[model samples]
Target: MSPFNNHLEVAGFEKILLLKFSICVLFSVGVWVIYTQKARLSSIPNSKKALFFLLSFIILRILPFLIIYVILDFSARSDVRMFYDSALGALKLGFVYRDFETAYSPIFPYLTALPLLIWDSAKAIVLEMVLVEGIILWFTYKYYKNSLGNYYLLLYLMLPAPFVFSILGGQEDIWMWAFVLWTCFILRKNSNWLLAGLIMGLGLLTTKALLVLYLPALFIFAKKPWQFMLGLLIVGIPSLAFMYYHSELLFLSPIQQANDPRTPNIWSVLHPLTNGFVPIGPKILNWVGLVSIQALGIFFAIKSKKTSKPHYFLVFLFLIISVWLMIIQQSSLSNYAYVFLMPMVFFFGEQTNKKWLILLLLLNLFVVIQPPIWWGIGMPIFHSLSDLNSGYKVLEYITEIGVVVLLFAFLRIIIKNFKTTNNSNV
Candidate 1:
């Protein structure tokens, strides 16, 4: 059975089943290898094991998906195509925002276009992403060697959210997370506020969602604010210059995006009450989300300033940003929230709550079963919600509700930690 679903029938269905089974086998064997090698996978000689784990993931996990992408050549998501185009456009003309239309920060075009200096194709974009992921994993292994075990590395790669989302979906959120993680590592390990702020400023230039982290991160750099501000200005000035030049196009994308109907977010719950004006509802919710996130960010930032465990504060800041990304953004997909996983592995280590991890993994499973939300298969089967049955509708609703619940859980943890800190002070 061909895995490419054209008619959505049993035609070539056997091939699809075989492919699925092969992927499962590969994953199981990969996990087995990690477990078998756990004894020797300690900190001193961790690189070889980390590299082995990365290769195994690429072969067992990513290779099959690469084959699938080849068979269904253009079935990949649009973000990569958009990135490729924006990058190419930036190279061909000028900057992406000044010339093309993208909501991404100004630096993304340059970053994406950097690859085009040697190669130019959607495949090249994915290849560049693979290299970026390899570099990120190497760094993660380096700073986090003491805490990160073979099992954590294996699971991080195999997890459906990070694996499929990064490889197949072609989302740049993974790259953003990698950058942010590296920044946090620098801040925590070296207490080098300047370098940390510089990396974070670059992160902000990659994705605006990083803004939610800036204030919270400030708490960690409070003693050396001047050096941090200097670092930010060094990398942030270029993007600011462009924004100053093209300030007119700045709000163009946001305005257009907000006018669309809400998706799996808090606004979606209020959308039904807004009549046909649901398209304009995010205009209000966007501001509300911003205020809410900032208020929480400031509170956590202050609380973090008083704590010795500053790294945990970074984790909470990441969680806050993830929640804002999940709920506040006018346009969001489930994969956007996986940025938390990078911090989760380092912070919780092997002692992390397995039940919650499993729950999050289960939520990501919904993406695999459901049709691609942002891809076009040249079939009319999944073009709209109307094309899907009431069952799919229910699934979508459940996914949204689950996100809200998760956001609330993180908020509760943040509040509890603050209260505990207050009592300890007294």
Candidate 2:
């Protein structure tokens, strides 16, 4: 029988199950979350309300795991054989066993396994993540006062995709949120590039390893460019050194997942759209397309009307696409759907109070309308591709391509800003 069928010898699955049952019985956080807002709303004062509300929220936040736990206990047992393979690989390599990751480091696997040893059944991981992600959101609101409003933290915690990912997929991507936001805060707000790059490097563990996602914004927003660059190097150089040391991995951390020969990427999209295909022999074409996407995004950033803002948005879009591409490239688009949610939040957030936040929000509300996931322009194409069994690769192509266009459009806005700056100087 496979490890999944047996639940590995890591701390006895039965013991873990007993422990979780005990915890659930002792603490009704999940149940409290289910009825939180309504229960607490009319009773609390304004000052303590948000904080009380947050506690109730964490319950719902952590509820998915409990539900999954029930299913896992009842027979919907997950084939964690894959997880075991990854962990043992780490052990065998004496470098932390990481399965399913060929091009990247073992940090993420360790994160998953570490939590399981203590809490059992991925619940421990999500619990830690909710707390961390919640703190980071609070930090964002406190500092970026103008950029955020009251209840934003609540909203971030409660977003449907985030809710599902945390409870269902048992993802730790939220921790990455802290690192990414830290990079942004330090480099853009505090002029600490070295720290920024380091945090950004650390952030790679959350999803894909993309160091420069927030750098362009630093360049645009930094009042002191020299200090900013110095800070960037401090944080970024260490990871770059590691990548080089593991040069065996070929510095492919960012796009390692995309190198899968099976899936269609942006370049693959070209084959379908152009009615011509590039032979998949050497990897030169993939590199070319990847570089082209970054270059295109950067070019738009330089050309936009609001230089700093566009730089941040473009960088954010690139990071989002890079992660989406990594997953879809392998034809595994399950549970990681939340990757699109953050980018959507930012894109729409940018236009808030500009002209059509109300209109856009209303339209987006319709997307969750009935039965199907209506991602607007994506619904028909995604459906057709699914019917053909090419859904995974095609979705990858569409999402990344859409990100590229949105990135470029935002870049155009930056170009206009630069021109205005130049003219003012003249």
Candidate 3:
């Protein structure tokens, strides 16, 4: 059977199963090689190390997907199709939210559609995402080279979540963090608060609206709060005015998304008990989740205010996003964990204990595979209350439990690191 829906039947990609298994083996070997050769790699020039990292990422993450989908004509599956449809819709309508319905922010559809102008295929969207991921990875390496070292890049590439979600699934979640990181990079000198804020606001416009959750923490951590606020308002006011004039659909998009509850969230776990019915309804749950996330962001901001270390800000950022994934109504999929993968790896990768690192790897594995199980097994067979089966129910419960455990594991790591950092300071 072809992976991701019988590509054997549709796309006629021969030996696809072998191809996939080979890619998996190769990725495992690549990771092992990097791990064992770390000492030798440390002695190499930074430029050479950077080249090796990029090449490894391409060979492991990019080439396999390209070979399967582009070279062999395997059909694009999952959210990439939706991304293509939204982009095509926006192209046809000449407007994103006004002309067609999309849950994404105002600028995303346009950005996705740009590639379609030349390539005119869904593959173009995947390639566009790959390009963006590459740029993000380059910048990440550049920014963290001195502090975290090249191992961070290698670890990030080795993680299955980024490859599965960003390259294979074509998710835009990581783009949100890419923007946040770029903002941090801009303000690394502690002199560019206004520019950083403008960049961040632009990121919010282009990426998911949830990126706003990072604002409170960012404001608290910023050296010049007033300047950042001014820059944010500069971009935000014009963007809001343009959105209001262009599309009433923009305002209605979030409400529309709230009606459907996704899997691997708290709501999904309780869905079996509720029989897909809640007394409060999904909209209320949506607001409640948002408020809860915002409250946590504010709390973390206040708690970490005294600590000016950049990594702590990232920890709080990861914490806030973790809370969002755990409780948010529309966050239904674990793939959104891509947003926090950077901080998780950067902070937790240095652990002397292998247990936390091992656990993190297992969680990444769970996250990478959860979407396929939910989509292929749970959604198809157990979508409706009447359709549920005992075996499928057990599998669904296990996946949900994995999500909950992953959330708690992240919280634990964050707290541990926080205390360790403070104690070292003392």
Error of 1 at 305 (Å): 0.9
Candidate 3 on 68-120: residue-level lDDT in tens?
67788867666888889889887885677767767788788889999999999
Q: List candidate 3 stretches off by more than 4 Å.
A: 1-33, 146-148, 270-281, 310-315, 327-330, 378-388, 419-426
For this target, which candidate reaches the highest TM-score against the unseen true structure?
A: 3
* Reference-based lDDT, each prediction: 0.57, 0.43, 0.67
Off by over 4 Å in 1: 1-47, 60-62, 69-75, 145-148, 209-213, 216-221, 246-261, 269-280, 309-312, 328-330, 367-389, 407-426
How does each model score on TM-score?
Answer: 0.76, 0.58, 0.84
| Cα lDDT tens digits for candidate 2, 1-426 | 432232122223334334433433333243234224433333455577457556746565545454656556422122233444444455454443112443334465555466556655434545555555556555655444332333334434544445544443344444545565565556445445555545555666444454344355445444455665665576457756764566555445446554544332334333445444434324675565456545544554455435444225433544444443432232223233344344334333433342332332222222112102212113222223233233323434554444333333434443343334322111
lDDT of 3: 0.67
Backbone clashes in model 1: 2
TM-score of 1: 0.76
Error of 2 at 110 (Å): 3.2
How far does residue 106 in candidate 3 sit from its true spot (Å)?
Answer: 0.9
Q: What's the lDDT of the predicted structure labeled candidate 2?
A: 0.43
Model 2 earns a TM-score of 0.58
